[model samples]
Target chain A: MKLHELTIHEASDLLKKREISSQELTRAVLDRIESVEKKVDAYITIAGETAVKQAELADREISRGNISPLTGIPVSVKDLICTKGLRTTCASKILENFTPQYDAFVIKKLKKAGAVIVGKTNMDEFAMGSSTENSGMKTTRNPWDLTCIPGGSSGGSAAAVAADMCLGSLGSDTGGSIRQPASHCGVVGMKPTYGRVSRFGLVAFASSLDQIGPLAKDVLDCALLMNAIAGYDPADSTSVPEDVPDYTSFSNKGLSGMTIGIPKEYNETKGLDPEVSGAVKNAVKVIEDLGAKCVEITLPHTKYAVAAYYVIAPSEASSNLARYDGVKYGFRDKEKNSLIDMYRSTRTKGFGAEVQRRIILGTYSLSSGYYDAYYKKASQVRTLIMEDFKNAFKSCDLILSPVAPTPAFKIGEKIDDPLTMYLSDIFTLSANLAGIPGISVPCGFSSAGLPIGLQLIGRHFEEKKILTAAYNFEQATDFHKQKPEI
Target chain B: MKITKDEVVYTADLARLDLSENSINRFADQIGDILEYVDTLNSVDTEGITPTSHAIFLSNAFREDEVKESMGADKALANAPEKEDGNFIVPKVINL
Candidate 1:
């Protein structure tokens, strides 16, 4: 059996009922990783012994009558998230060997919930790039189409889930790293509301925009993982103080009376493929068929989302990434004879060119002279975009759109043109900038056979609403049923 | 989307990424083009609208000052490329 394809809820039931041990599930995922990870390149660090130990512990716990929703399920952490003793590279060479002394807030929660972490998935360096191609490690290929990319930063997590390497995985989304890859790989990815999930253990990328979310093959599985991870952490000041409910309840009622809003500004963008647009439109129809009301809402400042994000994210990135000087922590070059030379050489070698470019842009925007012209203005515009959503949400419960302009593009297609690469994030960046919950659920595949995703956005802290809509749509469609041929 | 090598050097300096003349020239052309394309957003009239940075409506998420439990030194150094005295070891930086 392809055990990794089973949802966490499904696998946990069997394990809890004593049908199979947690170690069996862990070994199945590990065996699949051993057999398939070479082609997918989904993991930068695969934890075999630790995973086995955790599974054994979980098995013992289950035998001792310990049962939890997440018990005995194998999950992967995006390499950007600190995994206690595991190397959290963020796919950057500078931190290639740096391991954190503490578990990220989500890690602590998952461990408590009995999730057996299988491995650390690959990601774009510091969660910067939109394509896994920008990761200093090997490019993470989309399980759906090996020639194409798995969307990025969180590409490895998405690819791993789709390829059946893990039942579910954690992915940090800054500008759609989680959702875009989920779209590219034909899986489910959820970027929980900012502060909905604590950010304590995630290596900072764009601090304001970065969020650790779940990516799985189905909406329920994503919810199962999110429930374990989403809660306030004292370490992250941005963590919310609100109560987190069992989000799986949304799957029961579906999308009745939910207003699915379609933003008009998103429809008029250039490069939006007709096929992908049609798929989202059809998904909307399916949602309506399930008794939800589809409405047209306007987020007037939508056009400025990308521009505002470009300035804000880069500026934050510039500040957040400053800690990686060769002198402090992580890899320092043995060749550098001088401190300055070491700083330059270590950073130059550690970071990919794309990450370097953003850090520079961010630094420039935040520089003494240019700060007012860029960073401040971007922050001001950030408020405007928030207002637009605030107004739009007055009439609707959620927003629907395409996750990417098209299905997964071939590897190396837009890497040379940073603008084209930036444009790839256009559909995804708005949610991050707004700090709202966004998910990409499988809507359908394109004519060329690449998987397409339907983006569902919800009000801040209203992830249950979005997941409910997604779960209902998933029930009415066959998109999630189609697995990768690999 | 035209960019000059000087702009590349300027941005690199701002980013603290020291680059060679060759890399500067290469990134200049690429980043410059991206900047130009992104300029399309300028046409958007954000005149009165406040920019949005986070999606969660809640603010003031700061945590109370308190020490939390941490991993033990041996486990913490599991991925350290260099370690000594149960801490991450690095080249001397700021002299104490």
Candidate 2:
């Protein structure tokens, strides 16, 4: 049995009731990894022996009658988060051998709660790609359809969760990495408010836009995981000081008097499937029937989010990735005698082409003369996008939209065309830019049998509200009941 | 709407990522296509609207400087790809 599929609530109940030891649950996952991991390409590295040892300790504690909510539950983390003593490669050749000597703040928190970390999931090289296809090792395939991509940067976590490799996983969303893959895989993913979770040990992508969140099967399970992971951290300077409420407790309050606004501006079809739109409209009717008021709202600057995000993200990335020079750490070339030769040689061999392109574009934008023209203007456009969201929220308690234009496309469909690949993030990027919470829950199935996600977005640090709304919608619909045949 | 080999070479040098002639040619074609598409951003009317950067409305978020303990020297150098007796070894930074 793949114990990784059991929800935190399920696993916690079993452990509390003494039905199964934490060691047994952890062993079951390790056995599944031995059998099914090769087909999914989901993990970069498996800490199997260490995980077993930790689970054994957890089992001993429970035998002594010591337990926490996460005492025995196995949680998967994105490779980008640092794990002390484990080889934490951000799915890049440069960091292939760089093991962090200290656990990240999030890891420290998880350890305190007695959660067993199974392994690190694969990702784009430093969270750069829309598909984990950009992983230096190999592309992660979707559990639902092996031929299609598992939406990426966080693709491995999504794939692992969907395939029963892990019950829940963490993903860092720079630009729709978590929610998009969750949308594609027919699971639940959350992008918490920017400062709600700390970013201390996560490999930096776009500093301002990056956020770490949970991907699980149900909204309540996600909230349970989020309760342990969220809240302020002194290690992360940007972490906000706010009291984290019991999110799982608030989820049962259905959306009776809530006002959900649908941005008519998002109704435009750059690539949105008509069938997906119809499903979203139908979902709105369901919400209205639940006593929530559905109103039409306008977020006129919605279209510009993608254009601004690409420019700003690359600009920040170009500067952030500068630390990978063959000098201090990561991959270094011995063949080159000179310093410049070594830098060029090491990076040339280490980084993929798409990564190189973004770095160059960013460096050019941030260069003296071009800074005002590209980077500055993009920042200004970013302000407009945030303002658009602020005004939209005034008209409603929450905003709802389709997660993407369509379901997962074939593996090689947009690989050659970079612009098309970037366009897929249009609906999700604005939420990140606005620093609000957005959840992608399974909405309905397309005629093609692929999953469609209805994105529920709320105000800053309002994760509970978003989860409640999504749960209410979920309870009314039977979409989350269907699981992929893996 | 065309790019020359010179621009590709310049971009490659600027990025410090070694690119073969074949990769350069492919990038120029793909990048040129994207640049043309992004030109659509110019059509929007901003008028008096100001451009935005950060989403959260916070101004300053800086941590107070405090002395923290450091790891033992041996543990620090354990994961370095190349290391000297106690420090990380790297290509000399003579040029930059």
Per-model TM-score versus the true fold: 0.94, 0.96
- Native interface contacts retained, candidate 2: 0.57
Top-DockQ candidate index: 2
Q: Is the docking of candidate 1 incorrect, acceptable, medium or high quality?
A: acceptable
> What ranges in model 2 sit over 4 Å off?
A251-253, B2-4, B45-51, B62-64, B92-96
Per residue, candidate 1 scores C-alpha lDDT tens digits across A1-486 of: 456667787888788779888898899999999998879999998899999999998988898999898888899999988877787888887887787777889999999998899999988888888888888777999888889999987999999999999999999998999999999999999999888899998889888888999999899998888889998777787788899998988755567777878899888999999999999888988888898888898987777777778888888988898777765468777686556667677788888888888887787777777676677777777777777788999999999999999899999998887777878888888888888899999999888888999999988888988888888889888889898887
Residue-level lDDT tens digits of model 2 in A1-486: 345667788888899899999988988877777777888889998888888888988898898988888887787899999999888889889889888888887888788888889999998889988888888888899888888898887999988888777778899999899999998888899999998998988889899999999999888788888988898887777788889988887644557889999999888757789988988989998888888999999988778888778778988898898888876667888898777888888888888877887887677667767676667767777777788888998989999999988898888898888889999998899898888889999888889788889999999988988888888888898887687876
Among all windows of 10 consecutive residues in model 2 chain A, the one with the lowest summed lDDT is A1-10
Candidate 1, residue A464: lDDT: 89
Q: How many pairs of residues collide in each model?
A: 17, 7
Error of 1 at B62 (Å): 6.0
- Model 2 CA lDDT for position A35: 72
lDDT scores in order: 0.84, 0.84
Alpha-carbon deviation at A37 in model 2, angstroms: 1.5
